[model samples]
Target: DSNFLFLFCYSTYSNKVFSVTFLSLAVAVIIPLFGAIILLKCPIDPQPISFKEPPVLTGPLEPNFKLRQAERLFENQLVGPESIANIGDVLFTGTADGKILKIENGEIHTLARLGHGPCTGREDEPTCGRPLGIRVGPKNTLFVADAYYGIFEINPVSGEVIPLVSSKTPIEGKNLSFINDLTLTRDGRKIYFTDSSSKWHRKDYSLLIMEASDDGRLFEYDRVTKEVKVLMGGLRFANGVQLSPSEDFVLVAETTMARIRRYYVSGLMKGGEDMFVENMPGFPDNIRLSSSGGYWVAMSAIRANPGFSMMDFLSEKPWIKRIIFKLLSQETVIKFVPKYSLLVELSDTGSYRRSFHDPNGMVASYISEAHEHNGHLYLGSFRSPFICRLNLKDV
Candidate 1:
């Protein structure tokens, strides 16, 4: 299937012992690493949605008017495409499939893979560890936020792999679980990353909501000082940290709360938090500040299930959440109408001045981090393999 984004790990990458014993029970959802498939009922299939495109805005964009998708990037489906940045004339992508791909003009190239090349077609058992956010440094090195392995940097020229951080036992005793997204400081002296949850897997979204206790955190790793500091914590899935264009403040999105909070680094509000944007339509994932000002907040996907917005309250009651999980966890196919608008919030007051969206399900999870490179608007999708240049005029 061309749309085989979520493939069975056991079907391709199982160990010797696993292949011999767990081969026959195709009925069970065999987790390749955990081996023992937890017995569960079958899931339902959801119908694919079709979206409508937004109208053309030819003026200084209106904060008050409605908007929709201006252009569609790569078609079909790709998984978890994160941050998008450029290295000279080349474009690169870090995917949930554990691969980093290079793009030039409008063509695709396999830059490198975590365990194998793009064409090696290796079966999926957690090889590259799920590459998430990716950014190119000044020296042309690619830094990636890997799910299980922590932060990593790969030499774009040499294709050499280097580990920047991981959860291995330190000289002391602690664990950094699920390092999700990342960004660099103005001078590139520090790396700021998000640890989404300590006791949950990315696929188990329901469990994360049930146990949400503001467990996510923002960590800063200084390259020159060779130090790591816990900048902020007790956050509900702290995601999408971006350095303000002038390097004055760092803005982070709390997905569970559907809001972005700013931590001032060089202003009167230093060491305090200010509201950036609140009551967003979707769960915000990664956000980037534009060169001109304002930030591109990637609302990964809008909240459909009512429980998504009230995670804090839901986490307090174990029995209530468990009952809901048990009832809804059976479906194989999950469906929802994509939220039809994306806002370009103002940097000063976090007010929406411009927006984009559509009526169809033209997007999905962790769609893409929006970036204003040069004078053009480039749209990358978390679920699509290609990058696109949009003809969106200024609002």
Candidate 2:
């Protein structure tokens, strides 16, 4: 009886162990299989990107902690000052909450609101209206580019807001999706702007970068005739627009391509397109004409490793991007990117002059535009709560 009992107990223990191991094995296999199936069926049809080898950081492109010396203005009081424009001494910027603000004498005032009320949080950006780029136009009017809305003209003193362009306005049978930045002609008669993408909204910018689609375009709007003309198309994530010092050509930042493109407007090369700069070490955002004869380009992020960055890795692998988009939300994916701040100065000929870096983003991150005014560089960001200010003499 004792021998029989011992054998029965041993057999029961063996069966239990086998069942546990089998269940573990089945779970491991099924989970991966299900994941693979989901990844294969991911909805995003990411196009494979052929990126040029990023330029190595050396000489003027070398990294430095110079940006760490910047001082935060209105820290924790403002949110997402994406672009900066100044009228004399007073400063103007557009914030994430759909408001155009005027900063004067260290005081913040709401000059105009783009969207209607009840903007509770970031999720309401589409409805709340996110204003990206702001420029001072004729008669001290503020021209704003709202990502969700279109272009707006505001009188700073009267607080009067007028709609210049509507997002619903179709160009070439396709509506403008993401209206990013704008620059006014010397006489403020023509407004040159960028449409970032037709497929993605401003909030889905991460997905746009990951997809690397060439749906972006550059446009010119006649303030008098109310006519819009497409100057250039097939841009990959066009972010910034600036007129040359002589107004002979326009420079547009192709963010995903890490380059700036030149489109001749009123010269012998009219209607001609050429590369202004290429293979930048970081992704360029809003570009502004420097006080000198150069341009200030704010880099949203930098490639910590030249050829092995997360962007570089995903550039050639569409399937990997598909899998990542399938498993993670856009916000989460953006958060995974390493933080770094950079601003570069390029000569009018597109030659690199110098760069400022906050290698670890200790003071500022996600700098979208660097506006040079009155011996100071006013830094704008799409993520930070405040703007940064750096005296030019300090650098």
Q: Estimate each model's TM-score.
A: 0.71, 0.92
lDDT of 1 by residue, 298-381 (tens): 654554333233333343455554445445651321333233334354555676655554334343223556766766556656
In order, the Cα lDDT scores of the candidates are 0.59, 0.89
**Least accurate 10 contiguous residues by lDDT in model 1:** 44-53
Identify the candidate with maximal lDDT. Answer: 2
**lDDT per residue as tens, model 2, 193-212:** 99999888888888788888
> Which pairs, if any, clash in model 2?
none
lDDT at residue 15 of model 1 (Cα atoms): 67
- Model 1 scores what on Cα lDDT? 0.59
Give Cα distance to truth, residue 367, candidate 1, Å.
Answer: 2.4
Give the per-residue Cα lDDT of candidate 1 at 324.
50
What's model 1's lDDT at 41?
29
Best candidate, TM-score-wise?
Answer: 2
